[model samples]
Target: MSTEAVAVSAVSDAQQHTPSAPAQEKTVEKVNLLGMSRPQMEKFFEDMGEKKFRAGQVMKWIHQYFVTDFSEMTNISGKLREKLEKICKIKAPEVVHKNFSKDGTRKWVFRVGDGEGSLVETVLIPAEDKTGSRKTLCISSQVGCALDCSFCSTGKQGFQRDLTQAEIIGQLWMANYSYMEDVPIADRERSVTNVVMMGMGEPLLNYDAVLNSMRIMLDDFAYGMSKRRVTLSTSGVVPKIDQLAEDIDVALAISLHATNNELRNELVPINKKYPLEQLIAACQRYIKKDGNESARKHVTIEYVMLDGVNDKPEHAQEMIKLLKDLPSKINLIPFNPFPHAPYGRSSRNRIISFQKTLSDAGFVCTIRQTRGDDIDAACGQLVGQVADRTRRAEQWKKKIAQSNEIMRSQG
Candidate 1:
């Protein structure tokens, strides 16, 4: 599903920037501080007639120390803490269902947007890199998706709403907190070192919130994550790609599942609007870096291998041709099937052959190991409960039913 949805009504967008009221006020309005970046938080404190330095202190408490309660911030004076307790709140989405895979992958199903069954998921995967053990958190920017990329289970579930900045970054906050909650602040180290925005929704669609969340992630007082450690994956949102290059410096990944326009249009319907040529041009622009070849970065091309589709030698050769001039790394993901999914994973030999072709051509190619499939936490398996506004979920259900009936008749 697409990322153009907000779970709120007509006037909800304006509510994010409004100031909170103290407990003495009739409404006792509270502003959620979980989503605010350092600048926003500094403005918040300034507006509250407090010192701007309080922003860094509070941010360190909330992000580094994982302190949600204002009263628990001992270094801050009791009066200011009391005032903050009355008018401000550091809150994250509630974890509804938490599951762990045997392979050290963890998933959390979060309840968001008034809790009307609009669920989103987050995943934390532990792995080993050249440095040492690293945990990468897969964060979702939207509840469900609007871009119905035919192979994705979230698209079958349909789009519901764009997650608030708090909800978007809360997945990372919650995941990091899960590990450090029992440890002392001085001795605690970050559990999650990397983040990938490749889960659930198209992140660029929820532009502002996603951007602000990444800002907070890169802030030193907050998560202190490097721009290199955070990657934003999209289904070729062309204009946003350009805007992202201007706005932030995070690594970019394209969800490119096909080599040609005709097949891509069928697989990723958004390709109809932003075709392959335009998409590749945008990626090139994103990594251009003022044409300095020495400091140029590479974009990541994510291609999911299907049994008889997009996995043949011809397709690999076409991919090599498509990416010959661009600086990129190719990740070949095995198709993870969900209920009624129309595709199947390519065989190991076929995937190997495809990887060999690209690798032999002097491009970096790696196969993504299937992980957390049993718990439905693999790459394409996250299907959080979505209140489908597009009615795409109902249509998919009908389509599945028709396919099942055809199979039964043939039997």
Candidate 2:
């Protein structure tokens, strides 16, 4: 049997034996205004017996003006403000912990709610180009990932519930407000120039919330980011790829870590459902220029390099052949190590050689620089505290303990 088949069998066995956690019951009343799109917000106001324009006014106050407190909305009448305060809430995730890396990378661990509250992580990567410093916020769409890729730390934490639209967009709002805390109010244009949905979970799995949040990000009253500036990274959810092309026009990044199905199936289990050929076909459809010729966008192919696993020269040659026809750029990421991580980062020399192979093949290949690793904020290193619904967290803990015991015995 193939490595992927063995892994899949193991996962199936685990699932068959492991017991699931009991579901909780809770009641929520107030409307969280953070994630609703323009139409939804307008409908909300209309349903509340207020003028439809109140939605736009409130959206501007909450998003553009950075005013969360209803009392701070100065232009609104006192009676309206009181009514809004009683019925609505500008809900945002609470920042339970914040860490700043030496390279100015910032990571925030946000608390989602009460009673074994789920935690999600967001990362701000600072980059300096010829123009100026650009900050990109990597936001999470779910509390934890369900797709358990062997190499990802977040997947090790086990499956958790999808985040609400508020939780998704609130990440951007909180990051922007935190960045502009010291700047003058009049000069505060958002510090986050780009946003990427590549943090904790499979974004496509949480489609509606992610799409709604992206719309809010592109809304003029909110972040006002260009479609090119926002990216949605997926682990090859084939159907969602086609859905996204119809729903939004943001840039797409595929988390394609391996060259073939034999490897990819083990690295990304979703490949088992939607294989490489199907995924590539979906990408072709996604980038098809239906009517607009000038708006053609290239998909970003993200390949994480793991030492002695998928970083060989042969792998690079295979990648060149795989991506030959697609309008794409390859982003080679060096593996970021986490506690009990099964793989090691590819050597710098190996990474350089891999980039050269793709560059020689007439592809635009760039090696991603490692940032925020010290604070566990780099790629593939986000592991938030999740009350695992699948009991996979306990299994991971036991595996790590066994590994440590074996090492101690050898010593």
Candidate 3:
């Protein structure tokens, strides 16, 4: 989205102003209070003369417990909690709008701030499995995306700034909180067991903040989630994939929509820069690990099945060869379409045959059922509104309207 297209609920222009710099030096941009990890938060609390373990307690309440306001942490001393409220902010972008799919998927439109103002859009997908063990949250890494994949709505919205670690993690905290208020407390914490960084932005592009957010999620005192539960999906950012494996050691999923260099170059523009060969090599290196059970990592190749495009039996066979001997699985995600996405979902017959080919080749392959499309809350249908003061806002609204109409028709 254009800078002018940022919405009203976002950080305002006044919020972007910087104080005068010290001679010859730039003013220190105030650190975003939300991004700090539990240990880091503890250090800050200690420096402020509060007890050390207070950080752990507060972290648990904020992350696993989903307490946004300090006052809600009733066990914390009123005085100390009040002090925390004043010094740091636990922010959840205001949910200006929300929608639920018949399939039980939820998407919320939230306002996040940049130097200019706040912008919005996010989708939360609850698992549909009757007996599945995991509940997952799909989150946005940017307000909009820079990587304009030919078949993604967020991509067409164009580039917006990367979300800070807090903004990224805040989505989890907010979604968990919202979900908990409706469910029994006994079951709320267990309800959300997985997180996928597959929403809007190119995650590796916003590498540092993404890593920080991952650490917070994996922190035992905070979210206490296993490294295996969180998956960071990327569109082949070859170089950064290694660091993600080494530093975070979480599950990795690649957006490998096409089989060959030609189709991939069109489906994912990044393929042109780091084509299929280099990207596959990166995945191979990522699969190798040197530690205990926790360190043994694997990659998931997320293949979006487009009609007559990359959904053929030959394509599936080629995929098996490409991923041979790697500790990996193939996730055949049927295309979730939006306005101008330029593609259609593959026929069920084609999808089944493709899966059969891979399974016959001794590859672990599963066709993912499409969910949340009715509410525009599926894999790639997340785009939110920006009520600008001028014509640019109108342009954005038109695209959003058109996208929503497509969802309505599909439903």
Candidate 4:
């Protein structure tokens, strides 16, 4: 059987054997090796009746040497490696699908265990102009998304569950190893230069796992990426934003699709719970606490320009005004349309005009070059799972009918 089919069947077997639970208490069957600090790994070994220092040796083999099998930790005894393998799974979700864009962007689709089994997407983007200076990996925090932002395909998938720390970190490990294996020795780098949590979910909602995964990525013995090189993107989960600053203190990016509250509420539905005023306040605090040269951080506000929606010059002016006096950078992304999404991409002239307004207002604004749209690899284009036709079709029909009734009443 194919790798994807085997993964699906394994998830199916799991669902048949175990019952579902509350969102906060979802059970992840195995611990992954993606997010573990040297100290934490040592503690794990100590708990398992091994010397604490053995954790460091194993961590070196896993993260630095990229060893996939515990038995390959030659420093440890073969009998101990066998015991560890029996009790813990050290591998990542097998890469089931791989797509590369003409612009050196690569996307990998992995099968994650959710109800009936689900999939998640991640991307590795190379710097433009052959800078050879940076390679960034876009990582996902959840299997799918619960935050149904009107413009996002992953949001449309509905919430399944959060990925454990292992799952989150495994993306980096697997991608790094795979890349090293593919490229010539002369062109290869030591590790992924940057990490962005902008792929599939509202990251702050899956806070703990995301933080744990980041700890591993930032640890000196592991990925060791600087806090400035790591960015946590959020759809304005207000309550957790401040805590994120206090805790991990990495680069922060906000998905600010609309300039005002009413429009924002329409685009990113979470704004209804935490409005613009509260969300900006959280950003302000995050900046005051973590923004500086030592941290090497900048608050990036991602504005998705939607035609006749948020692409107006006035909207651009308001965005600049809102962000003024704050240490920030604005990334104006032209909306990338997908099937079933109602919005269209903003016109090129409109996008340029809007960018000019922000730049003229003394804000650092750049238009993100759209990539991988031909293969559904652009922004808000990750719908990882194909819904089970017979079951979800009935649910979709009911949902469409309900929407029609609401629209009829409004009209």
RMSD of each: 5.3, 9.9, 7.8, 7.1
lDDT by residue (3-117, candidate 4, tens digit) is: 2232233333322113323347643334344456565566556656678877677766677677767876777999878766654556676676788888778888877664446
- Candidate 2 lDDT, tens digit per residue, 1-411? 432232233223212111222224222244567777887877666655668888788888788767778998887899978877764578789987888999989998888866657888999999997769889999998877889888888897776688878889889999888877776655666789899999989999999889989999999877888888899999999999999888888899999999999999999999999999999889989899464232236889999999999999999989988888899989999998776677899999999999998999999999988888788886435443423455676787788799989999999
Going through the candidates in the order shown, the clash numbers are: 6, 0, 6, 0
Q: Relative to the unseen true structure, what is the C-alpha lDDT of residue 203 in candidate 1, on a scale of 0 to 100? A: 95
How high is the CA lDDT of each candidate model? 0.83, 0.81, 0.72, 0.73
lDDT of 3 by residue, 1-411 (tens): 321112111122213212323535732333234556765666555566667788788776667766567887777999876665544556666676678778777777777774446555566666646557556788788766666677776766666688777788777777777767876433557356788898878889988878888888889977877877888999999989877767767888999998888988888999999998999888888777544245345678899899988888788877887788677888998888775455799999999999999888887899887777777765435443333223433465577678889999999
lDDT of 4: 0.73
| lDDT, model 1, position 327 | 95
List the lowest-lDDT window of 10 residues for candidate 2: 14-23
- For model 2, the stretches where C-alpha displacement exceeds 4 angstroms are 1-28, 182-184, 289-296, 379-390, 397-411
In model 4, pairs of residues that clash are none
Per-residue lDDT value at 86 in model 3: 48
- Superior candidate under TM-score, 1 versus 3: 1
Ranking by lDDT: 1, 2, 4, 3
| Superposition error at 134 for model 1 (Å) | 1.3
- How high is the lDDT of residue 133 in model 2? 85
Give candidate 4 misplaced runs (Cα > 4 Å).
1-31, 114-116, 129-131, 182-189, 290-293, 379-385, 388-411
